[model samples]
Target: MSSIEGRHPDRNLINMPMKQNLVKEKHDASLHLISRDFETCIDVCQKALHVLSSTVDLQQASDHQEEMEEFIVIIVQAYAELDRWQEVLPCITQHYSGIENVSPNVLKVCLLLHAKVQEFSTCSALYNIWTSSREGREVNDSDLEMLLDIYVTQTLLQAGKSSQITEVVQSSQLSQDTKERLIATYSELVRETQLAEETASTTALPDLAHPQNIVDRVVAKGLRALRMMLMWIWSVRPRLSTRTLYSLGGLATLLIIATQGFDTSNRTLEILGNLMEHFIRSKR
Candidate 1:
């Protein structure tokens, strides 16, 4: 063993210079990307990846795998920035066979590229495969969030099936709190969509005599007022003394009492009032 060591030294020591060169090359490629020199970045990354792929030593190759991944990611990004999905798709498919084989960074960029090209079916398929592969497997919070945001929320939303978001979250292995938060976000989105639709309807029909249109306008105005009141409460909260805040709270309660038994034609106002009451009660 001593004789072998004396004759060959350490393989890692011999490969050290090559590794340093590869690292420096990767750094240069990253800098090129930051500088938006996509062409040069692609050239540098591809060359480094090729060199890393050619390494014959198992240990050396393993050591270089991470650097190689970085190279691939850089190349993919450069191609994407250049709007060369024609090349980027092939590059990614050549290296990674499936979602499980891909690094999160590569997956994110490639998914976005697919979506950019209106490849909704491909994105949906990839997401399904990922969910299947990850089933019964434990994932960190960040990864869970990323997958839900990219595949379920943004992708499906763009595909015009965003209503499926809650269903998907319900089926996911996410924690209870995360699922609730995602559902809340989806509800907010639904509310915003309703508001937009209401505005569009009101604009389309200038008839003030229509009862439905009148109700919509009132609901919209009430929503706006509720939002403004909430904002004002939050803004004045810090400046007011506890006694002043209690007085404000008392006045708000009196207002709520005054609103009770008011005409039920505007159900939205009642809902908003209930929400305000619940919020105040929770704060207290």
Candidate 2:
């Protein structure tokens, strides 16, 4: 009985100081966090963590595991507020042996952090666990699950891994509407990829018909008039009386002349006049 009492008191004495130190650390850390002093909060947490790590007693360490995890959570928030996301995973993995050992809420935090940094592989792994029936059972918060789904989906999309997203989209617990939207997004991405590939493979030739000078412009105008005339005739041919057909033919001829004669030279008109005179004299 004497030996038992002595061991218990000694153990209590050893744990008592550590508990006091942890309480002080938690208070200071909480103050720093409330004050928006993230750096200071992290420092306090680190100091406490050092002390926690120094405890060799297995029972004491197990007893203080919650405190250690709390410190890590504070550290995670501090790093996140600082925009030092790259350091978050290392900090988390340092305390927890692996992601499997992390609590669901903390694992969710890790997933978001990884997604934020666009770390696809790690984010994907966490996402799988987060949605798993056995290990990833988060509280039945529909909104939170949808939000996580959106984040993970966005990460996969940004990485151009839409094919890999199909499984996730189909298996997710999000509503049918959200799942449909994701599928639509995936289809759009695939279409865009195909279009891009087609565009790249085809050799684009320079357009040769674009008018460069007055002559080219006039020729282009004539070609457009010809096309218009053909279309008009095709549309009206079956509806025309003989008289109407003749009138339409004359109208079409005038239209063609107007388009082609605007830039005609005076020399060409003079030559036409000379030919008329020669024909009249020969007739006389």
Candidate 3:
């Protein structure tokens, strides 16, 4: 082809940008986000989105996937800062599909923004994906805290759902570490509740934990949590044969100590005694 757009047309067309011009063009909007100039960044990001949509077809989304995801991240973050929460999910969802792998930062942006607005449905979907997918599963501990805050605080999980928690522990794609943490948190909450009930007349329990802060002595979650703790302990007990119980003897011993660490009421003392007896029997 004559008069072609050949490689040597402009002296072997240099890809190396000479000035800071190219760097500025690529990162100026990102710098806006760093400075918390979200409004300016939002404009730049939206323009980038428009250009991407106009230039690429659905079939070519993979071609621009990395750059497009970066644009989506900036857009969502800007929206989050603006408190335009309702718009953030759709913005991420449109570009995010099954095959596309998003960065952890993008998952975080989606999860937190959705949680902030109490968008439980969307948050659940995002969380299920985050928990299940290997692509974005290695979450930071702080990010895990943020996720639990949304689950325990915002999402309305009925406290006594042993079946539900069991299902999650067994079937979930969450790592063993996450499952163990969840159970540990639940147990610690139970321990705290017992301690709080023992001293509640002098001190106040927090509202989110239960209604002991106010006139009511108990609420739905509190009762459910209390009952569920007992049920879980019992449910685990039946599986203990001589060998099994002996295997768990150390933990049983620990449990007796842990149970005693709370209130020392007659009922609690009875439990502690029973646990002590059980641990002794298991030793033989």
TM-score per model over all chains: 0.57, 0.44, 0.44
Say what the RMSD of model 2 is: 16.0
Q: Clashing pairs in model 3? A: none
Comparing 1 with 3 on TM-score, the higher-scoring candidate is: 1
Candidate 1 lDDT by residue in tens digits, 200-282? 98888766767755655655565557656755776767444445545654554454444443443455556656655655654
Q: What TM-score would you give candidate 1 relative to the actual structure?
A: 0.57
Off by over 4 Å in 1: 1-15, 34-37, 51-69, 197-284
Using lDDT as the yardstick, the better of models 1 and 3 is 1
Best by TM-score: 1
Question: lDDT values of the candidates?
Answer: 0.68, 0.63, 0.55
**Count of clashing pairs, candidate 3:** 0
Tell me how far the alpha carbon of residue 94 in candidate 3 is from the true structure, in angstroms, after superposition.
2.6
Over 39-90, each residue of candidate 3 has an lDDT whose tens digit, in order, gives 8987787666555544433323333545566777777877888888777766
Residue 229 in model 2: shift from native, Å?
40
Candidate numbers, best TM-score first, in rank order: 1, 3, 2
Ranking of all predicted structures according to lDDT, beginning with the best and ending with the worst:
1, 2, 3
* Candidate 2 residue-wise lDDT, 196-227, digit = tens: 87887664533444333454455445545544
